[model samples]
Target chain A: MALKFLVVDDSVTMRRIVMNSLKQIGHENFVEAADGRDALIKLNSDDSINFIITDWNMPDVSGLELVKQVRANPKTANLPVLMVTTRGMKEDIIEALNAKVNNYIVKPFTPQVLREKIEQIISTVNV
Target chain B: MELTNSMEKLFEKLGDLKSFFIYGQKLIPTLQKILNFMQDTVPLLESVNKSIAESTSKIPKATNQLHSVSNATELATTEILDLVDGISNELNSIFSKTSELKNRLQKQKELAEKLKSKYQNDNEIDEFLSYSLFDDELCFVDASSNKIQESIMNITIALQVQDITAQQLASVNHLINSIQEKLSGLLLDLNGKERESDKSSSQHESITFNENARYVKDNQSQKLADSLVAQTNGVKSQKEIDQLFSNKNE
Candidate 1:
């Protein structure tokens, strides 16, 4: 199944790798943003985006803040967010989960792991 | 009685004068002692005044020297502060420049990596294409036939096959050469296209390798070309053997 996925990361390399991996896994429809602010702008304009994969620390409006905003908005309240970041602190994980992130994948992950995590999140959200 | 009273007054006057003489006699020693004391104390007071004047005169000179020293100290301190500030500014500038250089270096590293990956991907595509087209098993029989024809062309007429058979062989060779040339040209075109695509974009553009494959599949003349070349090689080898036997009999 092809889902419209939004990939938010400050690193261009990381964005390309993620997009390529997703494409390899058979997800063709994807949008990219450099930071949470850009992601918010994209989301506001495109309501059809159902899945979001974002990095944690960014220059403007971090992933956690984006998640909170997404959860708060009635239009995007039920949107599924998967945080893929290098922040492995327990407190950060708890905070992200509290902010309504549906899933989390750590950095330095293989394409297979990313595919698995995306599948798990899609399944859990039933999107 | 008046004369006696006057006489008493005179006597009192005389008595007072006598008492005055007695006091003067006693004061003479004390006056001499006072003169000696003045003689001894006058030079001491003069020396003290002179010394006091000398000290008072030197005080201003000492104070001037102290002021000059203080001024020099203040100037030195100010200069030192200025020097320190200049050094600090230079250090700050250097640090900022170093930071900028570091950023540039990081960006360069990323670019080099991207270029390296692209080169590797290009090489992989080249290898795949080369393997598909030029592998030992996949080489067209026409290429070998062309090599054989070139060899025949190099040989002397003494070894040349009969003219009729040679004509037949040459015609087959021409067909084989045409097929091989077309295939090589197609492979070269594919390589050129791949190189252009690599140069134009970092992003993966849609490539239609399958389309080319389909074209290759639809080309029925290639099969006929292959068969003709194979037949020609077989006939040429038989002719060569027959010539060798005829030469031996002669």
Candidate 2:
């Protein structure tokens, strides 16, 4: 089965960028969510969403909170999450790691970097 | 009897002072964290600016790459096609304006350099002063050099927003620091001495403050300035900041 991704970001441009990047990598099946709350709703509604790529800073329900919520829920606990964010500080990375994000990529990353991170996570993790 | 009453009142005041110090001590770390976060925003803003500037500068290059890639393979989705088109359309105007500004600045720098070399020697300048057009030439060259200098200075000032913001953060850090220091001083006055643990905790905060100060000081405030001067055509990206830190660690 082809992997389905949930691309969550507040910026429509960034979401489109991620979507375009995914398309370049031959992964066309994905759902878009504007924020973490919307992402939770989509994740709940769609059982096919095997992976998540989210931005850290959002108006409501941040990416870290989303990761924590995902881990707390049994249905989505094992979902692979990759954090793509502008928060590049060491402390920020540590916080994301502590929140149990599968991988982290700081912006503005190349599409190739995004592809590799996704592959790295997908290959290592069951999701 | 009078002395005993005065001593009791003094003890009560001391107790209040100690309580105030304890509360102030509790707030130090959180304040430190906020200041650090604010300090971090400078680089974040600079990164945003760099990305915007670079994207604008790379429109043609990116458009060409898209053309090459699309020619090689069929696009997998409409989203990809839209994204490429969007990037091309949005950045096209910006790219043209940036290119025009870059060319003008380059020309200005070259003219300034040429003027400087022409009139740099004082003896030659003196001999030329006897000529009727010397004043005209002098005024023109001086104006050109001043214009070039003004442009360079403006670029430097623009990049210095990071430093300015960092300084503001540092000021807030210092204000909180002074408050903490005063609180500690009051506690010491009340107790007539410091407890070992309280002393250690205060020392820890002092170390953290020093660390924050050093972090600010170590920042390459001149990185943008230097790069702008060196690569008049190619502005450095966020990667330069990343590379700077990595190199520092090495």
Best by lDDT: 2
Interface RMSD for each of the candidates: 36.4, 15.4
What Cα-based lDDT does every candidate model obtain?
0.57, 0.60
* Displacement of the residue B156 alpha carbon in candidate 1, Å: 60
| Per-residue lDDT of model 1, residues B132-240, tens digit only | 3333432344355445433422231111112112223333433433443444444445345331222211111111011111111122433332232233232323355
Q: Could you tell me how far off, in angstroms, the CA of residue B79 lies in candidate 1 after the best superposition?
A: 52
Instruction: Give lDDT tens digits, candidate 2, residues B141-229.
Output: 55665565344333322332222233234344445444545555555554467633333212212211112222222224223322322
Off by over 4 Å in 1: B1-250
As for candidate 2, its clashing pairs are none
Error of 2 at A1 (Å): 2.6
TM-scores, all models, native as reference: 0.35, 0.38
CAPRI category for model 1: incorrect
Model 1 clashing residue pairs (backbone): none
Winning candidate number (TM-score): 2
* Docking quality class, candidate 2: incorrect
